[model samples]
Target: MKMNPITLIIVLVFLYPILKGFLFKFSSRDLKCDIDDLSRNISFIIAIISGTYFGKKIFIQHDDGIYRNIYNHIPQQILDYLENNNLIIYAIVIPIIVFIIYRVIKLILDLLNYVTTYPALDSIEKFLSSKGNIFKRTTGMIFQIPKGLCYVLLVAFALNIMSVLNVSSKLNGYLEGSKPYKSICKSIIMPVTNSNIAKKLPNILNNSFRIVIREADSGRQIEPNSDTPATLNQTNGRKTVVYYNGVTLDQGVKSDPQIDKLAVALGSEGTNTTEKAQMLYNWIGTNISYDHDKANKVLNNDFNVRSGAISAFETRKGICFDYSCLYVAMARTNNIKVRLVTGEGFNGISWVSHAWNQVYIPESGKWINVDTTFYKGGNYFDNPRFSIDHKDAQIAGQW
Candidate 1:
């Protein structure tokens, strides 16, 4: 029969101390020493397990506050480095802090044991020594069980860390293949450590791709007031466009002279609000391609969204956020009232975080939904069934 290497390793780890307990010959004095070692091992196990749980909880709760304090004192480059690698820093630093605290408590306990427990244990050891070899040996073997379990817990903790970090696919495969490891994690480690946070860490870290556009104010979608028009334009030589919610187009949307020029040229062909919006949308859908490289970086939380509109304009490539940002910029420049909406969209498999836009038609006096990102897929321009796929719509910004 074939044997899995990881399963073999785990079995060996579990069996090593049990074999030692059964095989080894020990005097009563040695058993007394083993008792002391068992006490220390039990304390160490409690400290490691509980300390890790509370430390992670505390860090998650106060991480933003800690970062803010450091931000004011550190150089921008250094702060950026810290922000980018904060998860790794937390993983290393929290364990060290917990170990330090454990050591200090252990020192106090050791001092108390020397003054009080040792003298009493000496009398007890002498009594046990007189009992028999059988009694002394049996007691000593029983103590070794907890010692073995302590080592098992340590291995489980290390595996948990590696899994959370996504250290290696091969190592992860080995861990998954090990039945002993899986049972230990499920029955013991997960309950103690609150492993849900560990499971969610990767998704939380990679959420930049999900929440691509930054929210404004409280980021809640408010229905437009009856007094507010579908479109607003202020003209005194320079045209200013506003949404039905009264947010000016230029506020969140970054403006570029080239984008403005192109928008003007496109809008000049349409002669109406809906037609102009359609022309800009069609041009973007035809010219721009989805940037897979940028998507990867965004997933890693490495891409910056500050220059997203201008970058998409120049490269003619972007993700959903970029498409929405570019559309808002161009539409506003052509005096069309628009908004950038963020929500989840079904990609025929699962609903993923996505961004799209809404344009106000002056003639119809209503705002219409549009998704240029799905332009290649189908007709997403004010489609009646748009709500079926796009869910939990929120107005990230209006222009």
Candidate 2:
């Protein structure tokens, strides 16, 4: 037997989760104590979760490059639509759907096996006085397979139609698919066949996405409503507090040599969001460096402004938390009400953990997020870049 990876994977995949469930059954005995009772159930559940994860990752990754592959492949359109806001599909829905199907299938198989041995497992038996329920359990299987097949066919037919239509413009959205759709599809046709396409997808999507989003958002019209939402709350106040404290002390020493250097470098407050934004921007970028990379330790760190912005008039390397704190302190010093913004940056990469700051301009009365990281080419600013579509960007433990 030639053991191909795909075949080996298929066999192991089915058994692994069932093995884990049995391990659970043996490790902790309860209603799940019956091994025979759960073996088929667990197998069905595993298939469902795998399907759901496959569905959700599709939409989030954006649309595909090929023609036929559009709805069926990784960048599939149908999966995106059904999967959006449907997180439960991954963690529970798929498993439930699979469980129901398998439960029915197993019963039918059991009944069929019984008929082969006894010629008829469907005979009505004595009530509770029966010697064994094994014989009793065999009675219900005959009708389930027909209903299960019908149910399976209906769902499969609907999903197939949805998957096909998703690639069509009639239902789902597409990225400008590329600078020009023809070029991108052509570029991918051969490489995709060779399996080199997945590595290039991020840049390809990035290139084509700006045009796509601009097209998508431009058509959106909204009735103007006057509702002021509160600023994004902070996870810690110490960063905000110490920044203002540094600024408070900086005010007295404004004429001192150290203060004069940064003041000139940052410029006057009335300049511009673009310009005044620079004073804080440059200070953070050039001064703060990632402190062994943990935001939770911000308060306990000893580097302070002395080894940071105060010392380096120009620096561009800091952790997301450090970059955010530097901007907060500098902006507050500029007399602006600065807020620290912290969040997940991309795809739950714990390493993508980040922070930035938002400031309120008295004239506009709106909180504008400022990302020294993005401005310095470090991390992306999710809100400005995608509004909210950037799943990788999360606002975690904001301060």
Candidate 3:
């Protein structure tokens, strides 16, 4: 008969002691001890609290109590099939999981009790006579540590699987935070890895530029020529000193220590801002590709840039926002001043909302516009003519 979940929980609580007593007998028989009633009760409480608290955190709460985020990642057709047969799956699965948990907890408690009551090694030899011959006693002690570790790993693997499916905590966020450390290892293996490079330079060079021509529906020139003096640069009114001295840890531009490592590697060979900026521009322009799918979705809503830098580096694909965020991440991490600019620009055929960067040059005391996306058309650096087609929407954030 179907029962309320609250009733089921109360029933389990009342039955815990009966289960504990049965488990205690098996465990004490193995350890050859009369484990105290108080000690066993305490151990039981500790185990229940730890397992329940951690289990609740690992399993996402839902109407049914708890679940994995399997529904989010799986295809609709597969989910439909699973939903159609869920009762059969649960009937087969629940009992097996319960039995496994019972055995694991029993093993854990047995090990705990054994260790807590363990005598001195010299005393152990004397006790061996009461338990078994020395051979059986020695074998158990020898394997116990490794056996405990294996169970620990099994538990950890199960939790990790849950964590991966649960979107509240992102796997990519951990990787992004740790990328700097990985870059150090990468630096060590650079020479050997470089020799095996399979990406053809010719394909990259040939695919660098594209031309688009759009016939104007109105016989007028697509853009009105402006002799209007360029609008005051965003940097013009601000204290330039702050750009050099202050840190702007802008929210969307998430950076890690690895960017410092990357900056040193890329710009260490060049002394000037022009060279450093060019190096950064080239790396981003060639290494990353526009994410067509995400870009299409973004036109309908918005985009997230919190992990944009690492995501672009890992996937090698992103929209204009990703390009700008990654640029700012590396530049700021390395103590360079970079601003993410949101604006309107002609995407060859028609005007579209876009994002790019303006980098501060220390020696020149001026800002230079650099567009990685426009670099696809070649010659994107320090172009005065660039402002003619691109109009600033508003500056998002700067570092």
Better of 1 and 3 by TM-score: 1
Per-residue C-alpha lDDT of model 3 across residues 219-254, encoded as one tens digit per residue: 221221122111222222332111100112243467
Best lDDT among the predictions, by candidate number: 1
Question: Candidates sorted by lDDT, descending order?
Answer: 1, 3, 2
What is candidate 1's local distance difference test score? Answer: 0.65
Best-to-worst TM-score order:
1, 3, 2
lDDT of 2 at 107: 75
TM-score of 3: 0.37
TM-score per candidate: 0.43, 0.32, 0.37
Q: On residues 114-183, what C-alpha lDDT tens digit does candidate 2 reach at each position? A: 4552332223222423545443233223222333333332333233223222334322122121122223
Tens digit of per-residue lDDT, candidate 1, span 161-276: 67555566567557655778767766677667554422322121112334311124444433333242323332223333333112233433676899999999999999789999
Worst 10-residue lDDT window, candidate 3 = 202-211
Worst 10 residues of 1 by lDDT: 198-207
Clashing pairs in 1: none
